[model samples]
Target: MIASVAFRNFKALRETSLILAPFNLVIGPNGSGKTSLIQAMVQLRALARLPLRELMPDDERHPEGAEITFRFQPPFDGLEASLSCVSESLCDFLQVTPLSTGGGVDDWVGLRARLLSLKSYRFNHEAIASTSALKDGGELAPDGVNLAAVLFTLRNTNPNIFECFKAELLRIQPEYDEITLIEQADHTIALGLRLAEGAEVVPSDNLAQGTLYLLAILALAFDPEPPAIVCIEEIDRGIHPRLLREIRDLLYRLSYPASTGDTRPSVQVVATTHSPYLLDLFRDHPEEVVITEKHGRTAHFTRLSDRADLAALLEDGSLGDLWFSGILGGVPDEQ
Candidate 1:
């Protein structure tokens, strides 16, 4: 997880940074770097599965422009970050820099991770761990979603850790009437949900996109060893408004302090949402609220914390109502 991120020369962002926290909500216009920022982190994780030199032009485009620097922390989780070599065609018209743009026999790319938390630990380039295949280094695997396979692999080697994580996720996924783990011929396990009428294993793909999205969120909750910051591109993409609060509460529970003598994931979630459902649910976690604005070529954060009228509106105990009250500036499009 990343506590904060600094972007240099990246799309729209020449040099900008934002402080991050668990259960983060990033709201902004279309061109804001919300997804771009999240994609930068995704690039970090994608390194494990693919060689950095393989990154294509399509890899970095979110809405528009270019990005240069990104910084994050628990000082630096030993996770990996991957990127294509700067020497590639993607940088053909690029002016380039001394640290990354210049070419050498060292022209390889892969994940690079920080060992200490950014909040407390200093930066160290050598602090990174990497595969011999790439010059870049860090913990994330290719395609980002491959994290699922990584999780499965880890669970196989660390049953206790896996069980601990699963319990926590199930706790957040309490809405499900029933859940089951099924094994496949390829030796992979899938989580199945039972609706009110019948009981059967429902494939993750078969479930609503929101379900997979929630499951992905729970993946952070299951990190056995939690991250300092976890960034998600879209928080309210495909779920029902009714379920948004459950996800928010789960995030809150995950971020809350562990019980006496009990261990929990120390994860912070940084996500983007258009749904007022999430906004209303997490409006109270002041430190976690963020609004992004896409003005001209740059994207920046806004003040969406619990303000005077907003707080009173939230007291009404209705997310839909609070949204319509203009807290986030308009009623949510429940369409």
Candidate 2:
């Protein structure tokens, strides 16, 4: 898993470094560079496949350029990749390369594939509900499309894992009696939900946004060939507050093995949330929470667990209350 990442002249993150946990939940107000942090990951992933110019187009915010350095933990302890860009708008000059050291060609190749496997999600409910063409599954689409195909594959290939996924989903949403997989005449698949034992299955297109979102997340977490790193933006969107804990747990299960019984490869998760309720869920796991605060044109990232006065802050109120009350630096400045 990526242990840490440092950014310089990258959008709002003029100079910032973030220590990542297996599961990272970044809470901050709008324009606090949360999205930029995720985008940095996306750009890093793109470098493995996309051209430098496409990845680092001239941005008015940072015409000079930017640099992103990533440091990994054990297994890849000494492996590091630094992606830098120097741009000249008039000449349209751009350069990008991964200056990795202490690893052979094979290691770099494997790391590149891992980087390419990093998936960022901002589920598009409509796209997710749309019928998916028949194809081999194991990976969920970035926008959460082709969900039915992936689920169908899981149901057929690994029934046990599918059952586990179903149980988890049902636990989060007990109202749904069962999950249905509808086969189309064109040899495609669509997802549906059964409200009662004998009730008709409601097609995904008709299902609530939260239900689809939850299913998409479960499918991703249960994926047999999961991505190396998963980034989710506004993860609490459309989900009820009470169910937020389940969502948090689900993401946690993706990272730590002790969080769940199922044996699977560790998959790092980085999620951004604007909800205090979701922030409260991570109070016990402050190491996995990062607060983003932007001042002027620069943004700073601070791990909640690194605070020197954490005990006193927790005494002030719940994690969410402190953050919402502006004691946490991530809150917006109204003065």
Candidate 3:
């Protein structure tokens, strides 16, 4: 599990650090650096897993090596590992490389785009990939394409798990009972997601924007060995308020263990949401609610549990109104 993270000049963060918990709420308005934080993690994790040489970097001045650190604890045995790297791909195109060019600045000059992306996560450093995103030196595509590869890998190594997930899909979509991977005569493999509800599985790409959004959310959130620390943007996007608690509970169960006989890894979720209904789901446990906004470029993560009068506001059924009205004291009061 990731104990904490500190980022400097990475995307929207000029310099910020936070103590990470198992289940956190990174609530903030859009563009308040919420996605940037998660993006920073994605890039850092990618670099740690993929060698800097395989990626294409767009910058050369900052050098993608401003230094990133990770303080992490592994699962099951609680093994510890750490990693830090020059922004990957940034130096891949530097003038020194055959396909790269140098910039005016030398110190981290290669990290121009994405603001140097100087960040880190805690993990086993040597496990860092020697050439690509696969933690093991095997060839694999970047994360944008990592999902499918991951499914295939899981299928081959853990057929039981894959079969279980397939059965789950069937249970969730009784009408689309048939799901599998097929390869045409051309040797191109494809996912056949069929829906039996008189509805077609339509492949993930052909899904309605709403369905696509929900599918992506589940895909990322339901991993077997989920990330130690995770941050999600607009937790309620394309999802109905009625499903907020259900999904929240799903995510929560994914993050922490319950009384089940089977053991699973721990996952921490940090999500930003605007739905009061989402907040209301945690009424019994106030600590999960975090409210945030920007003071110019700075992000303020506030705990709503600190407010003594929140119960009354919740009683009035104006959770959203109270939040925006500054009674919860997350965002700045409008003039």
Candidate 4:
């Protein structure tokens, strides 16, 4: 799991450091640099697969360029990269030259691959419903285009994890009891949802947006071999306010193990949300909430628990209430 992240000269994040938890919720108003922070991490992770120059080119317009550091848990060493020079260091052992030098040292390939395994969910309903078979050993696509194929593979290979996914899905939406896959003539499989024990199956294309999103999330959360971290943007976009709690619970369960025989690997979740309902879900657990505020060209990150004023205000009101009233600092300033 990622313990902390620090970035400088990365888009709106001029200089900021944030201590992350197993499950993190980033709440801020529009253009407050929430997405920028996620993009910075995603870009750093992409370095493992792409050259640094292509990801973060040296442009005179932004002389400072960008640098990011990720500190992970035990067994995996920390990594820091200079996007401007494309230099990288793993702990204190090795240092690599610029990207021009065959993309730095290759000793950190394993660590880089783990970081690159980080998944970002950008739900595409039409794509999620696609019946095309993906290559063997393929993982879930970012847009969820290959969701059916991936789930099919899981159902066939790791039935236990797939069953856990179905159980979690039922918890999120009690209407669905089972998930089925329909084989098409072209050898592709389409996802089918059984409403009840013997109810008529609903095709993936016919499923609700919220249902599809929840399925996609559950699949990632319960995968036999889960990613080190997952970044989700606008997590509450299609879901209803009442169901946000369930979604929050699902995320919490994925981040930490429960005593109910959930042996799946713990997967960290970093999600961005504009929904007050979602913010309220983290009221008691303020440490997991990171509030972002943009001032001019720089973005600042602060944990809700780190702010004494916010804590005091919470004595009389909820976190969402404080944020909506602009006491939390992420709201728009009305001059």
Candidate 5:
């Protein structure tokens, strides 16, 4: 997991740093660098795994002299990677340096693998409902376009994990008796839901928007080959407010596997949200919530747990109420 991230000249980030927890919920008004921060992490992942030319078309890249630095916690303590853009043109070239002298080439390789394992998702309702062509199993796409294929692969390869994923969905929406994957004559695949033991399978296209989103998330949480770090944008979208708690628990399950008694390695999760309902869920875990504020041209981040008078502040109202009332810094300024 990343202990902290510092970046300069990256979109609204300008020059800012944020201390992160295993599972983080970033809340703020629009354009306050919430998305920018996640993009910065994604950029770092690209830097670690892809060619510089491949990243040239990225909008998050600064023209020149922009840099990002990461400080990781153990078992990666004292290991840091810094990437600086050294080119003057839009074709920015990155120079990466590992600051840990004690770590060997194997350590660097491990770091690269971890970075390669990072996956950022911004699920689209329509994309999640669309049919997917059959292909070799891979990570869920950023837009979740391949959710069906991914689930299909999981069901075929790892039935245990797939069963867990199905159980999670059923818990969330008990109306579904079973989760199914239908393979069409064209070899394309679509997600199906069985309303009863003997009921006909309903295709994903007929599923509600929120059901698709929930299934996509459960699939990610129970993925056999889960990413080391998962970044999600608008995590609360397309779901009922009542299900936010379940959503929170699933994300926490990714980072806090011990809480569920799962033996799998924990995954670090960072999610962005504008929903105050979701923010309230993290009230007990203030360290896991970061508030973003954009002042002038620079964006700033503050962990809610870092507040000195949090006890007194909670007295005013619930965390969501306080934030919505503008008592919290994440609210928008009326200029």
Candidate 6:
């Protein structure tokens, strides 16, 4: 798992570092750099897949150069690299030339796969419902457009994981008893929701937006071979406030392997949300909550647990209440 991430000269993140947990919920007002932070992680993953030159941003503000440092949990070495508009290079400690062979080359390859597996999901119901079969590896697209296809593959290859996914999904939508993949005569595949002992089957296209979003979220959360890291933007977008606690519990269970006794690697979840209900659910685990604030043009990140004063205030009220009251820094300035 990623222990921490440090950024320098990366858009709104002029200089910032965030210590991550198994499950993190980032809360911030508009344009406070919540999206920018997530985008930086996504860009790092892109660098792992594409050429560094292609991934680097063409910004002249950071003349000295930009750098992103990723610190991983033990047994795996950390990575630090210099990035620039025209060139990019890895730190000497890596012991490998950019995209070349060396002592740390194998480690780099492994890290690359881990980084590349960092999937970001932003619900797009129509795109998700229209998905066809995945080419291979059952990888869902960043926008979750291939959600149905990926879940279909999981149902066929890893029935147990699919069952777990179904159970979790049911908690979100108790009306659906089972989920099945329907293959059309055109060879395109779609997800079917079986209701009331399979009396009726609702096709993917016919499902509600919230249902589709929940399916895609649970699929990523419970996949047998889940991505190393999953970034979710506005996790509470379409869901009701009352169900936020259930979703939060499901995410907590998925974030740790020991919780589910699953042999597969644990999936780390980093999500951003504006929902006070969602923030309230994470009150007991302040360490997993990150608050983003913008000072001048730079974005700063801090875990809620790191603030002693804030922890003291939680004794009197909920985190959401404190956040909304402007005691927390993520609240928007009236100006």
Q: What total of clashing residue pairs does each candidate reach?
A: 44, 0, 34, 0, 0, 0
1 against 6, candidate with superior lDDT: 6
Q: List the residue pairs that clash in candidate 2.
A: none
Can you write out model 6's per-residue Cα lDDT over 1-335, one digit (the tens) per residue? 67777867666676788888889999997877788767767767766675443333345334645566666654344444433322222221111133332233346667667888888777788887774854532787766777777887888899887887887787667887878786667656777888866569888889888777777777777777778888889998778888787778667666876775666767789999999889998777889999998876777898888887876798898888888998888877676
Report the C-alpha lDDT of model 5 over 1-335, residue by residue, as the tens digit.
78788877766676789888888899988889888778777877877776433334456555555667787766665576666665321113444444545343246567778888899999997998888988834788888898989988898889888888888888889888988888889877878899875687888888888988898888788888789999999999988989999999999889999999988998999999988888888777888899998877677888899888887998768898888998778877688
Q: List the residue pairs that clash in candidate 6.
A: none
**TM-score rank order:** 5, 2, 6, 4, 3, 1
lDDT scores for all predictions? 0.49, 0.79, 0.49, 0.73, 0.81, 0.73
lDDT of 2 by residue, 97-164 (tens): 33355333336566667778999999988988888876835578888888988898889999998999
lDDT measured at residue 295 in model 5 versus the true structure, 0 to 100: 79
- How does model 6 fare in lDDT? 0.73
User: Each candidate's root-mean-square deviation in Å?
Assistant: 10.8, 4.1, 11.4, 5.6, 4.0, 4.8
Off by over 4 Å in 1: 1-9, 14-16, 42-112, 115-178, 186-191, 194-199, 203-205, 253-265, 306-335
At residue 218, what lDDT does model 5 achieve?
A: 89
Give lDDT for model 4.
0.73
Candidate 1 structure quality by residue, lDDT tens digits, 85-195 = 343112222111123222222322211332122111111112111111221112333223333454455466667766765665556555555545544565554545666
Residue 258 lDDT (model 1): 67
**lDDT for each residue of candidate 3 in 64-157, tens digit (9 for 90 to 100):** 4432333333221121122233453121121212212322223222232222322222211121111122232122222223333444555667
Model 5: pairs clashing at backbone N, Cα or C within 3 Å: none
- What are the runs in model 2 whose C-alpha is more than 4 Å off? 50-63, 87-106, 136-138
